[model samples]
Target: MADGMLGYGTTVRIGRGATPTWTPLALLGDIEMPDEQADEVDVTHMQSPGRRKQFIAGLLDSGELSIPMNYIPGSASDTLCKAIKTSGEQVLVEITLPVPSGETAVPEVFSGFLKGYARTAPINDKMAATATFRLSEAVEP
Candidate 1:
């Protein structure tokens, strides 16, 4: 399912950290990036904190879920700058997952597994920089 079409009840797990592991719990269709207008703001600079907070707030507000920042990995500094340069006024967040062939419940299982992974996984500086979201339900379009 496409990220844009994900449902409100759908759960999402965003992969973050140095090891590319899942950490944050996110609702699939609930994620959003609200439009912001900042005069004289540099896209590169605005993309980091501004975009990150927008993403977090939108998802949390829509899904009514809370995710700890310590669990995610990946620095917003470089990534934000890169995203701004590439997308102009917008930032791109790419999500990839293994889609199960037969069972449609794979995404939900993945979400639960990710939550468990976050609970037991060790935190390191490298692993502390990424962002992850585990959604409430599997998205279906």
Candidate 2:
């Protein structure tokens, strides 16, 4: 397997609202890729012989996209904080990442809604907010 370009894993950005024009959503720390699960069923038994069996094609459960960033008092990312702080309904947002070894401009879009948001003020560090978005649906037609 070929190793990827240096710093490629750090490529991440987000956009807000329907038909969001992309933006360079900054990050203050590591970005966690959405966690996935491969559920399995036990199917070893009687007729033949004792054997272990399970399916790797388990349903891919929905995931949470948590973004933690330094809070700029008036930065674009602030929208994320506002999203969770107060809301009338689900707010649509878009998370983008480059296709591995491919063009950075054309990203893979994981569009969904903001599940929740929270802010933190560490005594000795810059104010920050962790935006947790639940990826519930695909936007591509």
Candidate 3:
């Protein structure tokens, strides 16, 4: 048995505004959480003895979250993704992780706009789709 929680029961929900009515996305395959990054700011000056680069952290970015799914045309997930992209509106995405045997599920929430929704079809493989959410604010882990 593995010590970590399994990804099988994880689920993602999305909706509009600061407070929203979350709609569960369906047929999702796997979800990749956002990778946060911070910008490095250089603070080197002429008075520095060894000319070592002095640095500081600038703005923090709650990188993009990508969701891959089995593409189902006209499904709620498909329709919502398209609508969100077309509207260019900020939405709240809540990703709930699977709970361990004795622990509770925690949802990571963030606000972002749907960057892209791409669909693919192959003759020898199952149809698939992916949605990229570009985070605009700090993620609540």
**Whole-model Cα lDDT of every candidate shown, in order:** 0.32, 0.60, 0.88
Q: What number of clashing residue pairs does each candidate have, in the order they appear?
A: 23, 0, 0
Q: What C-alpha lDDT, on a 0 to 100 scale, does residue 92 get in candidate 2?
A: 44
Question: How do the residues 72-105 of candidate 1 rate in per-residue lDDT, one tens digit apiece?
Answer: 3334432432333343331122334434447454
Best by TM-score: 3
Off by over 4 Å in 2: 1-4, 8-18, 21-24, 42-56, 88-106, 137-141
Question: Candidate 1 overall Cα lDDT vs. reference?
Answer: 0.32
Model 3, runs deviating above 4 Å: 139-141
TM-score of each: 0.20, 0.63, 0.92
Q: What TM-score, to 2 decimals, does candidate 1 have?
A: 0.20
Q: What does candidate 3's lDDT look like per residue over 31-124, in tens digits? A: 8788889999988999866978888999999989999989989999999999999999999999998886798887988899999999999899
**Span of 10 residues, lowest total lDDT, candidate 3:** 1-10
> Of 1 and 2, which scores higher on TM-score?
2
> How much is 10 displaced in model 3, in angstroms?
0.9
